[model samples]
Target: MELDRISNLENDITQKIFSYLSIKEAARTSVLSKNWSHKWIVPPCLVFDDENGLSTETIVSHVLLLHNGPIDSFKLSSRKDLDPNDIDQWIHYLSINSIKEIIVKKRNRYSSSYSISSNLFSCQDLTHLELYNCLLQPPSTLKGFGMLKSLHIRRVTVTRDVLEEVISHSPLLEKIILCKLGIRHLKIDAPNVSFLELRGGFEDVELENTINLVEVSIDQKRGSTNSSSLLKFFFKLPRIERLTLQDSFLEGANGSLPKKLPEPCLCLNFLSISIRLNNLEDISTAMCLLRSSPALQELEISVQQDQHVADAAEVTGWLNDKQNRPFTQLRILKVTGFSCVKAEMDFIVFLLLSSPALQQLEISFGRKAVEVVDFSWIYDNQNNGAFMQLRLVKVTGLSGSKAQANFIRILLSSTSTTLERLTLQPAASAKELWELFKLLGEFINRVSVPAVVLEFLDPSNSVQESDDSSSSSDSDDDIGF
Candidate 1:
C-alpha cells in the first residue's frame, strides 16, 4: 500500500516534500518503501536553503549524490555563515549538470566575500542567471552561454570590458539588471534587448549599437560628475517607447549642460521623471527632454523638496507655448509631493491649459498649509471647449487646511458638470469622509451629471508606516516617482 501511494505521487508532490525536509529526512524517505528508495535520484528540480539546520557542505554533498539527470532549475542559498569556496563548488557542479536556470543568494551577513569562476559563464544550457554579492571575473572570451536570455547581478565587482564581451556574445538576450556594481562603462551590442534597468553610483553606460529597445528605467547617481555622460548614452537608444529617469543631476560643476539630449523619434506615449537640481540650467536640461518627447500621453513628474520651481522657468516656458508645446494628445497627468509654490503651480497650470484632451488630473500636496490658487480662470479662458472634456480630479494627502479646502471647492464649482470621479486621501475619519461625500453629492445633483464618486483613500491605512523611518538620504535619481 505504501509503495502504491509513493508511485501515485507526482514529481511536483515529491519535490514539495523534498523542499521542506532536511537531507536526513529526505534520505530517510528512501526507507519508506522500495519504490520510494530511488525516486529521489532524478527529481526535476533541486533547492537547498541552509535555513533548516543543514550544513552547507552536507547539503552540497547530498545534492551531488542525488542529482543524476539534467537539472531543469537549481536554487542554492545559505542563511548561515558559509565559505566562499562552498558556493563556487556548488555553482561549478550545477554548470556541469547543464542546469537551465540557476539562482544563488547569500544572506547579507557581516560583509562576506564570494567569487565566481569564469568557466561558469560557459554553461551552454543556462538561460537565466542571478547572483547577489558574488565577485565575478570576466571570461577570457565570451565562448558559451549562447542561450542566456536574462542576467541580474547585484553588488558585484564587474569590469567594463567583461560586461561588453558578455553583451556582444548574448545575441538573444532580452533583459539585464545591474545594481551597485563596480562596472564603470557598459556598451550593449545586443539589438534585440527589450528591457534594461541600471542602478548604481557613477557608472557610465556607453552603448555602441542602436537597440530595438522598448522600455528603460535609469536611476542615476546623484552629485556625480559623470551624470551628463550617463544621460547621453541613455538617450541615444533609437526606438525607446517608455523612459523613466529618477533622482538624476543634469548640470555640471560650472552649470554647463550636456551637448545633446536623448531623442527617440518614435512618439513617446508614456514618461515618468523626477528631477533634482539647485540651478536653472538643470531645469533647461529637463525641458529639453520633455520637448523632445512629442507623443507623450501619460506623464508623471516628482520634484524633490529642495528643488525650487523658480529655477525651472525654462521648462515652464516651453510648456506654456500653446502653439509649439501643446499637449494635444495628453490624457492623464499625476504630480506627487507638490508644494504649490509659484514655479510648481505655474508649471502644472501651464500643462493643464495646454493639454486640451486631458481627462484625469491627480496631485498630492506635501505640506500642511497653503494659499489657495483658484483654477476657475481656466474654465473662463478655455478654448476649443477643452474644459468640457475634463472628467476626473483627485487630490491626496489633504490636511483640511482652508487653502486646500477652498481649492477643492473651486474645482467642484468649475468642472462639476463633466467631473465623474473625485478621490481624496488621508481624510481624518470615515465620518468626515461621509460628510464630505454628502456635500459633494448634493453639488453634483444640482449639476445634472452622474453622481460624483467620492472615495477616501486613507493614507494612514494604505501608506506603510515602516517606510517612514527609512531615510531618503540615498540618491533619489533611480526612483523617478
Candidate 2:
C-alpha cells in the first residue's frame, strides 16, 4: 500500500513503467537507486521535442550513442535551425537499429525546411512515416518502401514522378494524406490504398489503379486555376463509398455539368458538399452530383455566406425538371448556414417531395430571413402522403413569425406517428440567441403531435466549440499513423 514500494517490483515491470516517462524524467530515476543507474539508457521508443532546454541534435545524439535496444518508434521535432547533417546521422543510426515508425515535424513556418535524408529510406522495417514542412527527394537507387502501410506528407516538396514511384513501389500501402503541397499533377498507381485525402490543387490527378479505395476527400485551393482536372480526377477513381468536397474545389466546377450525367455511382453511400452559395450555379452543380449518386444514403451541405442572393426564378426552373425525382435511397440530409431565401426554401421543399425514403432532415439557419418563404407546399405534399415515413426534423435559428411556426406545427402533426425528435439550434450573436430563447415557449405551446419531443440547442457556445473540435480532430488524424 506504500508508494515507496513501487521500486520493489520486478526489473521488467519497473522498466515498463519508466518507458512512459520522458528521457530526462527516466534519467532522474537514477538518483532513487543504483539499480536504475544506466537503466534509462535504452527503453525502446525515443521521442525528442522542444520541452528540454537542450537542442534536438544534442539530445538525439546523446541518446543514440548510449542506447542499446531496438527502437520501435522514433520522433524528432525541432525548429528550422537544427543541423541537417546531424539529422541525417540520426536517421542513419535508426536504420541500423531497425526503427519501425518515424515522425519528423518542423515547428517553425517561416524558417527553411530540411530536405529528408535519403539514408532513412533504407529502413526496410519502417511501416509508418509522417513528415511536415520538409523536402522529399527519394534516392535514385530507390527500391520503394517494402513494408510501409501509412504515409502522411504535409507542406512537403516532391515531384509527381517521385510520389508515383513511392506509391507504386509500396505493395502494402493503405492510407495516405497529402496537404498544402507544391505540385501541379498527381498520378497514383497504388493497388492497396483504401483511404486517400488531397487538400491542395493540382493540374491533374490520374488514378491509374486504386481498386480498393473506400474513402476519398478533396479540398482544393480557393479559386484554383486547375479546377478542370478535379472532375476528371473524380471520374477516374474506382467507385469510393464516401466523398467530401470543399467549396474551394466546387467553385471551379460551378455550372460545368456535363451534357449527360456521369455514370451512376452505385457504390457511393455518403456525400458531403460545402458551397458558398454565390449563385444558382453552385446549387445546380451540387444537384448534378446528387442525381449521379442515386444510392447515396447521407448528404451534408454547408452554405457559406455570399453577398449575392439566389435567383429564385432561375432556381425554380432548374428544380422543376421531372428527371430530378427519385432520390429513392436517400435517408438523411444535413444543411448548415441556411438563410431563409425564397430559392433556398424551394430547394428544401423539392427535397421533401423527392426524397420519399428520407428519415431525417437537419437544418441550421441564420439570424434573420431576407424574406418569408411560402412553404404551403409542405402542407400540399403532406396531404398527398409524401412525408408519411419521415421520422426526425431539426430546424435551427427558428423565425418568430407565425407562418414559420405553423410550418413546424403542421410538419409534426402530419408525421406524428413516425416523428420522434425535433431539435432547434438558434443563430449566433447574443441578441438573436436571447430572442430565440424567449420565443421558445410560444412555439412549444402550439405543438399538438403526440409523443413528439421538442428540443432547443444553445448554439452560442456549441457552434464555435464544434468547429474547433473538428479542426483539432483532423489535425490528430493527420498524425494518427
Candidate 3:
C-alpha cells in the first residue's frame, strides 16, 4: 500500500505515526489529505528545531494552542537569540500539561540567556529533564521531583542552594550530571541515584543518604586537602561497582585512609584512575584506593605529567619493600599517558610480576615518553622461560624509539605464547606514524601471532574503549553525567 493508505489508518494510529516525524515534517502532512490537516496538532512527542527554519517560540506557542492531549515528551532547540520570558511561558504550558520529559538546548554561542520557569518545579510527572546554557532559579515552594529519573545540567547558572533543593526534591532520580557550573559544594541526599558524574570546578561533593549508587565518576583538581570530602563519599558507597577517578580523588585518600582501612569494597570490579605517579604522596594515594578494592578485575591507570617529584630513592625503596597484597583477581591492565620514565616502567613490571592471573596488558605511550627510554631491558634480561597467561596485548600511542621497538618485539616473542591478537596504533601526530610502521616492520617478521589487526586512528578518532565500556552498566541509558 502507498503512504497515503498507511496514513488512512485510525486517527490514534496516525497520530502515533506522526509522533515519529519532526514537527515540520508532520505539519507538511497536511498536504496529503484533509484528514491529515489536524493530525499534526496532537502528537504526543513534539520537537521544534529552530535551526530548521521554524521559530521555536512561535511553533511551541502554536502547538500549545492546538495540542489537545498530554505531552509525553517535548524538545525545543534554538540557535537564534531568545527571550527568557518566552521560554518561561513555554515551560509553564508544559508543566500544566503534565509533560513527561523536557529537553531544551540553546545552540548558538550568541543566543540570549534563558532562565527556566519556576513553574517547572511543579512538574511531578517529569521523568527526564535536560537543560544546556540556561539559568535555573528553583522556586522556594518546591516540594520534590517525585517521578524524575534523570537530570543533566551543563553550562547553566544555578546557585548552590537551588541545585541542592532541586536534587533533594528528586526522590526517584537515578542519574545526575553536573558540569561547568560554578557551585562550590554539592550535597546530594537522593536515595535512588545509582549513576553520578561530577566534573568541572567544584570544591566539594557531600554524599548524604544516596546508598544504592553503583558507579561514580569524578573529574576535578587534585590535592591532599580534598581527601576529607572524598572519604565521606567513598565511605557511603559500599555497593559501588565501577569508579573512575582523577588524581585529585587519590589525593584525598592519601593522608586519610583509616588505620583499619574501611572495609574492602567487595562489589567494586573495575577501577580507572588518572595519577601523577612521580609524587610519593600520589603513588601512595593510588595504592590506598587499590588496597580497598580487593575484587577489582580490570585496572586502568592514566599516568599524567605533573611538576611535583618525590624522592625517587624513597619511592623505589617503598616499591621494593612494600608488602602490599596482590590483586589476585586482576586480569587486564591498561596504562595510558605513559612517559616511559623509570617509575612508570617499574610500575608496569610490578603489575606483571604481581598479577599471577594476568591475561592482557595494554600500554600507550605519550609523545614525550616515546623519546625518554631505552626499553631494551623490558624483556632482554629475563631468561626465565616462564609462560604468562596473557591472551591479548595492545600497545597504542607508539612513537619512534629503538628501545620501544625492541620492547614490543621482545614482549611478543618472550611472553604469553598463547597471545591471540596484537593491536598496535601510532601516536596522533603524523611525525610519529612512521615510528609505528618501523616497529611493525620488525614485529611482522618475527612475532608469533595468529592474527594481526591493524587499526589506524587519528587523534580525533582515538578513544579508549575501556572508558566507553561504562555503557555496559545498567545506568548507561541515563544522560551523560
- Per-residue lDDT of candidate 3, residues 1-481 (tens digit): 4477755688788867886788888888878777777778878888887757767678878878898777889887666777778887888888888899998877653456677888888788999998877788876687768899999877789888878888888888999988768776879988999999886576678898888999998776544235456556777888999999864666655666653356778899999987767777767767777778888899998777766666655666777665456778889898877766656766666677667788888887764643553443454334433336677788876666755665566566656456666777666653655665666666666654545444455555455433322222222122221
TM values, all candidates = 0.77, 0.82, 0.82
Full candidate order by lDDT, most accurate first: 3, 2, 1
Write the residue-wise lDDT of candidate 2 on 359-426 in tens digits: 99887665445455566544443454446678888886554554455555556655767888878765
Give the C-alpha miss distance for residue 22 in model 1, angstroms. 11
Model 1, span 67-165: residue lDDT tens: 666677776666555676766676677777788888776655236657776658757788888776667785566663688888877677777777677
* TM-score of candidate 3 relative to the true fold: 0.82
Off by over 4 Å in 3: 1-42, 66-68, 107-113, 222-227, 251-253, 258-260, 310-314, 367-370, 373-387, 431-444, 447-461, 464-481
Off by over 4 Å in 1: 1-57, 60-64, 67-69, 77-81, 107-110, 138-144, 249-264, 276-282, 307-324, 365-387, 427-448, 458-461, 464-481
Clashing pairs in 1: 219-478, 235-262, 246-477, 247-476, 247-477
Ranking by TM-score: 2, 3, 1
Cα-based lDDT at residue 292, candidate 1: 68
Q: What pairs collide in candidate 2?
A: none
